[model samples]
Target chain A: MIRHSLREALLSLWRNRFMNLVASFTIAVSLLVLGLFLLLAHNLRSVVAAVGSQVTVSVYLRGDATEEQRDRLMDSLRGRAEIEGTEYLSPQAALEKFQRLFPTMREVAGELEENPLPASVEIRIAEGHRDPDSLRQLAEEMKRLPGVDDADFDLPWVTRLRDMVAMARAAGVSLGGVVGLAAILTIASVIRMTIYARQQEIEIMRLVGATRTYIAAPFLLESSLLGILGGVLSLGALYAIHRHLAASQGGLVPVLRDLLTTSFLPRSTSTLLLLLGLAAGALGGLLSLRKISL
Target chain B: MVELYHVNKDYGRGNHALVDVNMAIEKGDFVFLTGASGAGKTTLLRLLFREEIATSGKILVDGMNVSTLSAFRVPTLRRRLGIVFQDFKLLSRRTVFENVAMVMEVTGVPRRQQRVKTYTVLEMLGLNHRVRSYPLELSGGEQQRVAIARALVNEPALLLADEPTGNLDPNLSWDIMTLFKTINIRGTTVLVATHDKDLITRMGKKVLTLDCGRLITH
Candidate 1:
């Protein structure tokens, strides 16, 4: 009998080809938009995190500071708990790197025979001190050192970048929340229509002594199948869209293929979609049955 | 067996569909519930099938208080009762064979037994040749016959048929009633709700008469 009910459901769906098409298409489109936002949020988060890891504060040497004074200043900065490690870029080493990076800069360097480039210490802060307020306080402490000419910390840009990342995150979360709500509502509406279309049939089934579960099982299976199929198709669509965008803009969005890339809906997420579809269908069934007597 | 103790089914404050109706039928007995339009004939049948709970008092079917049966247990109660509706209620998309087989299938009869029983019942009803025909393809009388076949396929302990012959010719009505009589003789208690006084009087079964939702005579 269960098989018969399933067969009946599928056959009916097949017979109503137009309705089935409409329902599936609505589900697919809603999921696609949702997937697109999810992919965007995932890639943006990766890029921001990568950029945040690479920024460091550079503190230049004092004019009267000797080599020993510079060494002491470096040690003092390194001794601080927030400073991870320090790299000393002497004037000569800085000039050599510039010469190698831009051969044309060698002639420019020779013109300034004294090698005007200042000896700077590149201070790498522990990740815990990556926040703007902490970096500013650390730079102030280092500026008080004996040999430090003036501490030059790219503090403002770091703060701006953090704010931008935060804004992106908020935007992503908000977009996801809105689209997810729309997707769920779309599923609910379509399932409701499906139930309404079969209201008469359900009434007859109840009158004929079918149990609540018996009357509801087939509809639940039908809606869940649609949702699972939509979720899978959304995963594939998101991946395809991600691949297309990555090929077009790989330079800007290098993290397009990160851990959270649009691939198959994670097993847990797809399972959730399936359950949500079933729940939507079950809710419709229950509402339709509320006043009906068996 | 069936018993209704002061069965009062009121739809609302002022509208009474059945009022203080008391009745009883013994095991293995056949009865006709007779009344005119708005006479609560269908209401009485609905009460027996547990389709509508009585507003007050109790209805017992086969020693079970049908009025107290929960929605979950209604199907179990219905499994022992066969009901033939006036409109046949055959699924329009299904063939006659499927319509008959559904009843047995719902009752959890094994597939092989369902096939055997359905075919035998169809053959008995002279519908073997039309088993593959959909309800829409069959005549009114033939559809009613299929409905009867479905109702009897499970060999229900009690049969409640509502206007079984309303859509049939006199000859077909007699034929269908004769089939009901045979099934009743085989120990299936039958209660038929109908307005055809001529047919009920001719059949001479114990008739319970109703007027304005009250038992007028018996």
Candidate 2:
């Protein structure tokens, strides 16, 4: 019975070509826009995490501060709980690291006959406490410590990047939600029209002893197929667009490359797109059930 | 194999379609229901087929209560009966063979057997060469024959037809009657609703006449 119904549904899809095309167009467009938004959101989130993880505070110690004072500062930093972890970089390690960054400056550093770099406590703050206000408060508290000479961070730029990421997320969700609903309505309307065209056939089927389940099965099958097909088309389009952008080699390319190593949709995200497309189609079919059985 | 006891059908505003209608049809009997327009011939047939429930009554066809049948079971009851309409109601998009073989499809008959049985039935109805023709391409008489073929393809125990010849010419109508006679001879109970008094008298079958939703004679 299911086989026959499936055959009938496939036939219906072919017979109602124009209506099916209309439905597929709407679904594809809707899913494509939603996919693009999610893809951008994924990249944005990666950037935010990358920036968030880079926030580290180095507290420079005074040249004359006692060992007890250093111990007291280290213990206070550990007890604050805002710190993820800390590493003590002595004057020698700091000089070596600076030389590693600028290899040509090694002779200049040796000519000084003394390490000019300060012995500092490098603090990796917890992700949640890395906001501008909290970091400022932490830096102020650190400057008052007995062994601390200075505490500083690039707060202006980091604060701007965080605010921008939050705004982009809100905008993506709002725009994607509105368009997705419109696409679902389009699918439902198209299915409704196709079913209406076959009203006479359904009535005749009933007269010939067809159960209601048999009569309604074909419509459901057709709608679900349309949905999944639309999803595939959307994914294909997104891939093509991503490829185009990747090939351009413009100012955006380096930043995009730095943030995202692969194309827009990762394996997991593409799977989610497929499942979402299927759900939209199923929901549209369900909405039109009462009309078809009429 | 059908029984109706005190069946009444009301169509809102106190318009009764069938009132206190009691009747019985024995197995293998040929029965005719006659009345003028709006006298409830269609409604009575509708009730027997479970298309509509009676306001107050009991209807048993083939040992199942029609009035109490669930929505899904309506198809099961219909599977054991054949019904033809004046409009033919044949699917215009499908070929004669597809339309005729659809009953077997509903019963889950294998594909090979469906073809064989459909071919045999169409050939018996003198529609062998027209098997590939669509319903719109066939003549009125031929269309009516295809409808009959579809109804009988399942070899049901009973057949109910509402004005099966109302759209055909006089000669075609007589031919259809002969076809029904041959079916009745093969031991299937047949019930037809029509108002052609001349044809009714000539056939001399069991006639049930209705007047104003009331059964006047049997």
Candidate 3:
């Protein structure tokens, strides 16, 4: 029965190649749009994670601070419950770190008469205390220390980044849902047309006592094949677009290079997309069959 | 074997397709249902196969009550019987072999068995040489024979044909009747519905006549 149904589905697809191709292309375009949003959401999530993990408050010391005041500040920072850890950098060490980070500025630093960079202590916040309010309170308290010149953290920027990630995710989900529904409807209409064309054959089959399942199996399989084909086509198009953007050297490529470093969809996600395609096709086939009394 | 008791089929709005039609055919009997157009000959045959359930009656075919048969069980009942039509109802896209083999395929017959059974039936119907030809490529008589082969490939217990020769010439129609007679001789009960009184008189079989949805003679 499976072999027979498979043959029937393949034959039907071939006979109505033009219409099936149109349907498949429509599905492909829909999936492609959804895939693009998913890719954007994935990259945003990665950015949020990377930025959040590196969040810290930096406290610069006064140039004229005494050794005793510096020691006292270090002790106070260590005693704070919200502080995960702290690393102190001397004036010369800070200069060296700055040069390493900004290689193009190394020559300018070498021409300086003396080290002008500030000595600072970097404070890593504990996971539970990393919220904007808590970090602001910690920074304000540090700024009141005797040897601390200023204490600052990019809490607002991090918070904004998180919001952007959330928005991207929500938009991706909503758009994907709408596009997926459209794809299913397209497939259903295509199958309906095919059923109409083969009405005579179907009537003959019914007259000869073909079971409902036997008659419907080939159509169900055909829809699923269309969905799977569309999925593969979308994946191919996505990969091609990704390759083009990754290889381009001008325009927004350089500006967005940091975010574009993100990899393609993971294997698990790609597999899930394929399954979604199959489910949508199957659902469309079922919807088309509802009105048919076979 | 078939039996109809008080068979009543009513199309809504004062249209009664069959009225209190009571009849019976013993096992292995060959019978003809003769009537003018719209006289319920097709309706009676359809009722036997549960295509249109009788408004109020009991239909028994091969010991199964078809009048009360559930929707899902209709296919099971139909598998035990073969039905041919005036138009032949052959799939134009499929070859003669596939058309005939389709019956066994629907009933879940094994592929190897389907091939053997399909070939044997075609050979029996004298259509062996036309197996590879499409329906449109065959003559009217050949197409009808292919339809008959499809109906008989499964070796049904009963065969019901509705105006099977309506589109064929007199010679071709006679040939089809002879084919049915041969099938009857091989022990398959046959019930044919037709309006050709001349063919009926020539065949000399038990005849059941219908007039205005009422069985008038037997």
Candidate 4:
């Protein structure tokens, strides 16, 4: 009987080819959009961590500051709990670093006799003090230090990037939830139509003493297959779209592909989405079956 | 055996479909439920099959209260009761062989035995040659026979047939009734609901007559 019901379900899916197609297509499209947003959010989070890790506060020294004053400032920074480490680059070292980072800038710097670059102390803040507000406060305190010409770091933009990543993630969650609901509703509507189409046959089955489960099992299996198949196809479509983005080098695709370098959704996330699809299908079928009597 | 005590089934708004109906039938008995249109004969059989619960009253079939059987237990009760309808109610998409086999499917019978039993029943009903034919291809009498075959395949203890011959001519009606008699002799109690007075008189069976939802005579 189990085999019979499964066979009946498969046969019914084939028999109602058009409706099944429509249902599957709707699920696929919805899941695909959800996957795209998730991928983007996942990538933006990576950007926030990467940018956060690379930024620091550079406290440039005045040319008139004595060696003793520079040494005192370095000791003060090292004693602070929020300052993880520091690197002091002399004027010559700073000019050498500049020449190495930008080859084109070396010609302009070489034309000047006195390597006119300020000696600066680059401070690496502790993880707890990495946010823009904390870095700005620390920079303000360092600016008042003796012989400090300027204290600055590329803080605002990285902080903005972190905020944007968080907002995008929240939006992704809402979008995924809305799309999942739409998929469930679509499956339920299609299953309801199937129930109506077989109303006469179902009535006869009930008359003959067939249990409600006996009649409902096949519909559940059919809808479940529809949803799972759609989920798998969405996964494949997302993969293909990412591959295209990764392979091409022109236009905005390259910028987008940089974020997607971690690959499609993680294996666990993929499995979860597939399971969610199957559950949605089963739930949809049961919702409609509730209206029927055994 | 079947028993009913003060069985009153109200459709709604105080309109009773069956009013104070009382009846009983022993095992292996053949009884006719006779009444005019709107007489509640169908409602009475439906109650026996547990299709509709009584608004007030008690009904016991083989010691199980038909009116109060739990939802899950209804299928168990129905398995022991064969039911037929005037329209034949055969699944048009299935062949005669599958249609008959489907009844046995619900009982979880082995497929091989299901095939054997279905073929035997079809052969007995003179449908062996049309085993592969769909219901739409069969005549009304043949379809009715298939319905009877399906009802009998499970060898139910009781058969509740509602208006079994309402859609047939006199000769076809008598033919189907003869099949019922044969089933009854085999120890399956048969309760048929119909208004065919000619056949009712011809068969000379115990007839329970209903008038306006009330038992006029038994």
- Give the top-scoring candidate (lDDT): 3
lDDT of 3 by residue, A48-97 (tens): 77777677999999999888988998888777787879999999999999
lDDT of 1 at A11: 67
Sort by DockQ, top down from the best: 3, 2, 4, 1
Tell me how far the alpha carbon of residue A278 in candidate 3 is from the true structure, in angstroms, after superposition. Answer: 2.0
lDDT of 4 by residue, B1-218 (tens): 99999999888997889999988899989999999999998889888888889989999997788888988788888888889998888899899998889887876789899999999889888999999999999888999999999998988999989999989989999999999999998899999999999998999899999999999887
RMSD of each: 4.6, 4.4, 4.5, 3.8
Q: Over all chains combined, what TM-score does candidate 2 have?
A: 0.84
Candidate 3 scores an fnat of: 0.86
Scored by DockQ, the top model is: 3
Off by over 4 Å in 3: A57-84, A87-123, A126-154, A253-261
> Each model's DockQ?
0.34, 0.59, 0.69, 0.51
TM-score of each model, paired residue for residue: 0.81, 0.84, 0.84, 0.85
For model 1, name the residue pairs that clash.
Answer: A62-A149
Clashes (candidate 2):
0
Residue pairs with backbone atoms closer than 3 Å in model 2 (clashes)? none
Q: Which of candidates 1 and 4 is the stronger one according to lDDT?
A: 4
lDDT of 3 by residue, B1-218 (tens): 89989989999999999999999998888999998899999999998887888899888999999988998998999999999999999999889999999898888888899999999999999999999999999999999999999989888999999999999999999999999999999999999999998888999999999999999997
Model 2 Cα lDDT, one tens digit per residue, B103-213: 888778899999998999898889999999999999999999999999999888999999999998889999999999999999999999999888898899999999989
Q: What C-alpha lDDT values do all the predictions have?
A: 0.75, 0.85, 0.88, 0.85
Q: Residue A288 in candidate 1 has what lDDT?
A: 38
Clashing pairs in 4: none
